[model samples]
Target chain A: MAHLAMATGFLLILIGAWGALTNRNLLRMIVAFTIADTGVNLVIIAVGYMRGRTAPIIDGAVSAADAVTRIIDPVPQALVLTAIVIGVGVTALMLAYTYRLFEKKRSLDIRDYTDLKG
Target chain B: MIKRFIALALVVAVGSVFATLLFGYTPDADLNLTARYYAERTAADLGAANIVTAIVVTYRGLDTLGEVTVLFLSASIVGLVLAKGTHAPHRTPVPVGELLTTGTRFLVPLILLLGVYVFVNGHLTPGGGFQGGAIIASGILLLLLADPLKHFSHSLISAIESLAGIFYVMIGLAGLFLAGGFLDNRILPLGTLGNLASAGAIPLIYSLIGLKVGAEFASILAALSETEEL
Candidate 1:
C-alpha cells in the first residue's frame, strides 16, 4: 500500500509538472502546481507508512508499552500537516496573483504577458 | 507539438528517477531512535494520547508557529494585493435559492461546532487545528455562496485573528518563563492521558491555532470573493 501510494504520488507530480510547464493558461498552471503540492504531501506521508502498524494515537487498542512497535512514525504526519497548510497558503497567494494579472491584462494566457521576459 | 514532446520527455525523466527511489525504499522494520524516543516518552512527558499532537504542539512547536506565520502572511498578502481590485464596478448580486440559503444557515453552526470539537480534542484524536480550521473555512465558503452580496464584517474576523495570535504568543512566552522551554506543554500539569484536558497546553495551543487559521482562511476567501469577476 505504501509503495502504491508513493507511485501514485510520483505520477501525480509528473503530470502536474508537465501541465504547469507546457500549459499557457496561468490559472491552469496554478492548478497544476497545487496538484504537484498534493503529490509532494502524499509522498512525504507515504514515506512514514509501515506495514502491520497502526496510527500513533494511543487508545485502548494500542497501549503505550507496545506503542514503539505498533505505531507508525509520527514525525512525518506532523511535517505533512504543516506542509499541506503551507501548500494551501501558497496556492491562495498564487491565485491572488493570477486574479490581479487577469484584472490588469484581461487575459489568462501566460504568453500574453511577456513584459518580464528577457 | 514540440513543446508537448519536450514536456513529456522531462516528465518521463523525472518519473523514472522517482520510480527508482521508490522501488529501493524499504519500510523500516523498527522505529528509528527519534521515533522510538517520541513513542516511548510522549505519553509520560506530555500526557497526550496523540503522538502527532505531542510532536506538533510541543516537540517542534516553533516550526508549527512558523507555519502558522507563513499562512497568516500569505493570507494577508492575498488580501492586500486583491484589495485594490474591489474598487472596480460591482456585479449585480444574484439571489440564491431559498433552500440553499436556509440550508447554509442551518449547517454553518453545526460545521463551526465540528471544527471546534476537532481542535479541542487535538490532544486525543487524529484531527487537529489545521484540519478543523479548513472545515470552518468551508463553512464560511458556504455562507459566501448562499449570499453573494453579504458582507462579512472585517472587524470581527480580524479581531478574532489578532486575539488568537496574541494569546498564542502569550502562551509560548508563559511557557518560556514557567516551564522547560518556549512553547512547552508542561506549563500546565498534564492531566489524565486520555482525557480532554490531558495534554495541558496542547489543546489550548491547537484551539488558538484553529481560530487563527480559520480566520486567516476566511479573510482569504472574503478577499477572493470580493473581487469583480473579469
Candidate 2:
C-alpha cells in the first residue's frame, strides 16, 4: 500500500513537472511547481511508514519494549515535516515574487514578462 | 497516421523492456536486528522517546543547524530582492471587513499559544520547533493580511532574529569547546528518556531555531507587505 502511495506521488510529481514546464501562465507554473514539491515530500514520508505499526510512544497500553517492537520509523516523519514547513516558506516567497512580477510586468503570462532577453 | 502509431508502439515496447531489465523488482529483507540496535541505542544515548526528534535535534544537530541556516539564507535573499529600490504597493486603504479583523484578533493569541506549546514540548511529542515556529509565522501572516493598519515592530523582530541566530551559533561553538565537536549534546545533562528536559542541547538548539525561523518569516512577510517606497 505504501509502495502504491509512493508510486502515485511520483506520478503526480512528473505530471506537475510537465505542467510547470509547459504552462504559459506564471501563476499556474508556480502552482505546478508546488504540486511537484509536495509530491516529493509525500513520497519520502510514505517510505517511512510500515504495514501495521503504532505511533512511537510508550504509554499505558504499550510498554517501552512493545513500543520498540510495534512502531514504524519516525525519523523520516520528522524530516518530512521540516521539509514541508520549509516548502511553505519557499512557496510564500515565490508567491510574493510572482505578485511583484505581475505588478511590474502587468501580465501573468511568462512569455510577456521576459525583460532579460540579451 | 499508421506510421506514427507504429513508431509510438515500438517506443513504448522498447521502454518497457528496458525498464524491466534494468529495474527488476527485488524482495526486501526484514532487518529486525538493525532496527532493534538503532532503537536501543537511540533510547539510551538520546534520552528522547521520539527517536526522530532525538536524531534530528541531537545526533544530527549539525545538519539541523545547517538547515536552519539555509532557511535564513533564503529569507535574506527574499528580503534583498524585495528591498532593491522598490516602492510598496499603492495603499488603496481598503476597509478591512470587520468580521475578519475581529475574528483574527481573537485567533492570534490562541494560535501563538499553540505554536509555543508545540515548540516547547517537541522532544516529547510529534511537533517540533521548526513546525511550531512556522505555525507562529502563519499566525502573524494572518494578522498582517486581516489588519493592514496594524504592523509588527521591525526593530524588535530584527533584534530578536539576529540575537537568536548569533546565540545558536554560540551554543554550537560552546558545544565544540566543551565536547570537542560542534553541536555535541554533552554540555547539558541528558536526563531520563522520554522526559522534557532530556536530550541535552537539543531543546535549546531547537528553541533557537524556532526563534530564528519565526522572526525571519515574520520579517519576510512584513517586507512584502510594506506599502512605503523603499
Candidate 3:
C-alpha cells in the first residue's frame, strides 16, 4: 500500500512537471504546479503511513494508552496541514498574478511578454 | 520540439529518481523517535484527543504561526494586487439559475455551521482551524457564485482577520508567560481528555485560526470576484 501510494505520488509529480515545462499558457502551468504540489503532499503522507495503524487521533477506538502502537505518525499530518494551507495561499497568489498579467497584456500565453525593458 | 523533448527528458530523469526512492523505501514498523515521543506524551502533556492537533496547535506552534503569517501575506498580496480602485465594476451579472441560487441559500448556512463545528471541536476531531476556515470560505464562495455582484464588507472581513490574529498572538504570549513556553496548551488546565474542553487552549487557538483563515480567504474571494468583468 505504501509503495503504491508513493508510486502514484511520483507519477503525479512527473505529470505536473511535464505539464508545467511544456505548457505555453500561464494558467495551465499553474494547474500543473498544483498537481506537483499535491504529489509532494501525497509522498509525504505515504512516507508517514504505518502498515496496521489508524489515524493519529486519540479516540475511543484507539485508546491513549496504546496509542504508540496504534496510531500513524502525526508529524507528517501536521506538516501536510500547513502545506495544504500554504498551497491554497500560493495558488491564490498565482491566480492574482495571472489576472494581472492578463489584464496588462490581454494574453494568457507566456511567450507574449518580453523581459528586456530596453 | 527540442524544448519539449528536453522537458520530457528532465521529467523522465526525475521520475527515475522517484522510482528508485519508492522501490528502496520500506515502511517503518515502529514509530520513529519523534513520532513515538508525540504519541507517548501528547495525551498527558496536552490532554488533546487528536495527537496531530496537539502537534499543530502547541508542540510546533511557532511553525504554525509562521504558516499563518505566510497565508496572511499571500492573501494580502493577492488583495493588494487585485484591488485596482475603490469602485466595483458596473457590469450586470447574468442571472444564475434558480437551482443554484436556492441550493446555495439552503446549503450555505449549514456549511457555515459545520465549519464552526469543525473548528470549535478541532481538539477532539480530525478537522481543525485550517479545514474549518476553508469550509467557511467555501460557503462565502457559494454565496458569491450565486450572485456574482454580491458585495461583502471588506472592512468587516479585515476586522475579523486582524482581531483573530491579534488574539492568537496574545494567547501565544499568554502561554509564554503563564505556561511552559510559547503556545503551550497547559496554561488553561488541560481539562479531562476527549471532552469538549479538554485540550487547554487548543480549541480557542484553533477557533481563532479558523476565523482568521476564513476571513482572509473570504477577502481574497471577494477581491477576485470583484475583479471579474461580469
RMSD of 2: 4.5
Writing each residue's lDDT as its tens digit, candidate 1 over A60-86 gives 989989999999999899999999999
TM-scores for chain B, listed for all candidates: 0.96, 0.81, 0.98
lDDT of candidate 3 over A60-117, digit per residue (tens): 8888899999999999989999999999999999999999999898999999977664
lDDT of every model, 2 decimals: 0.92, 0.72, 0.94
Per-residue lDDT of A107 in model 2: 86
Every candidate's fraction of true contacts kept comes to: 0.94, 0.19, 0.94
Better of 1 and 3 by TM-score: 3
Model 1: chain B TM-score relative to the native chain B:
0.96
Q: What's the count of clashing pairs in each model shown?
A: 0, 0, 0
Residue B73's lDDT within candidate 1 is 98
Give one digit per residue, the lDDT tens place, for model 2 in A8-112: 666667657666756788889888988888878877766666777766654454456666667766666767866876786687678778777777867889889
Candidate order (DockQ): 1, 3, 2
Residue A13 miss distance in model 2 (angstroms): 0.7
Chain A TM-scores in order: 0.97, 0.91, 0.95
Pairs in clash, predicted candidate 3: none
User: Sort by TM-score, best first: what order?
Assistant: 3, 1, 2
Superior candidate under lDDT, 1 versus 2: 1
